[model samples]
Target: MQKKSLDAVLERLMTVFAVDSDSELARKLDVNRQTLGSWRSRQSIPYALCVNISEAEGVSLDWLLAGEGEMLRGGSISPTSKPAANPQEDAILALFRSLEETDRREIQSAAEEKKRIRDIEQRLEDLTEALAVARRPA
Candidate 1:
């Protein structure tokens, strides 16, 4: 995997930390806002601060350095995050994730199919009960 440039790393860190600007990042890193502004504008940031950002955001150091590995340690996918590991599971998750975007629409459709068959059987019981009730003395 190609190593991500320092700027790219910082950008991801900023996004992961949910900070809108480098000044906010500097505040979190306990560094001067001017230093962070220079770093972001010039594509330079301290290694120590990088490490701090990774630790604070639960990112793997390796992934931060290179985009090859999972971004999050726990393999969670944020709105801007990418997939991490378990190739097989990832494929399965992709399928489920690709399902039509509705409230359990796939599951509900399958359940409705099953319910149709169940309703047929239930109607027989209902008919039998109705006949028994009709045949009984009033």
Candidate 2:
């Protein structure tokens, strides 16, 4: 896999949203075209809006954020992969998905913060945990 820049993210989003141009994407996202250009210039997108699109459009957050998975929910990079195999995990995910966007975001933020603290305490990966691998050993 190659580097996933903001341009790639935006391009993937355009593909998902079926927009032919940035102007059309901006219109669909309800932002101004200049605002979209500014995002391209800064290489950043608002977290809340990304979350909104992921949940509302039934897309995968992993794909939206890191380009690590299929564009649709419950699918990752691996063709045979399943999002959740455990029944308890499936139930919890169902509950999480039922929450409002703001609540879901609060939960996600808190979970990330907790992971950060754990990483520091355990001397594991960095605070961002970007280097953390969640893969199951073969």
Candidate 3:
């Protein structure tokens, strides 16, 4: 597999966290400035750090790592004071937001179809157990 560019990932991290400098980015990542510099120099970032940033900042790992799909897991942009550099991304976000409620639901359902099927199966199992209890005499 091709390795991702750390500089690009770091740039996105700065934008997503609204940090103006590498020092600020390090602080946001909860690491020392020197360590952040080392990662930049090595062109690699730790997976644990990525997971931490994703969970803490509500960012999508896919977008942060590969610049694919929406930035946030819920497709909501971070509430940053600075505007994102990409206007096309902003426009796409606007179009997605303008979609009707049912349309949004359909999109979410399609995105999470596997999870929905697992949930349905769990419900079926619970109902089956309930029916079995109902059929038994006290």
Best by TM-score: 3
Which digits, one per residue and each the tens of the lDDT, describe model 2 over residues 1-138?
233477777866775666657898899899999999888777788888989999999898888878675668965357556454788988988998787544654576577779989878777544336444434354
Model 3 C-alpha lDDT per residue in residues 16-106, reported as the tens digit of each score: 7656678988998788999988886777889787888888888899988886888688875467855757989788768877885345545
Question: What are the lDDT figures for the candidates, one per model?
Answer: 0.66, 0.74, 0.77
Best by the lDDT measure: 3
In model 3, which runs have C-alpha deviations exceeding 4 angstroms? Answer: 1-4, 76-138
| Residue 133 Cα positional deviation in candidate 1, in Å, after optimal superposition | 54
Off by over 4 Å in 1: 1-4, 40-43, 74-138
State in Å the error of residue 137, model 2.
Answer: 75
Residue range 1-138, candidate 1, lDDT tens digits: 122486566656654554646687677667798876677566666677668767887887777765457766766557567545788988876775566423233444566779988999999999999999999998
User: What is candidate 2's TM-score against the reference?
Assistant: 0.51
Score residue 22 of candidate 2 by CA lDDT. 88
Clashing pairs in 3: none
Order the candidates by lDDT, highest first — what do you get? 3, 2, 1
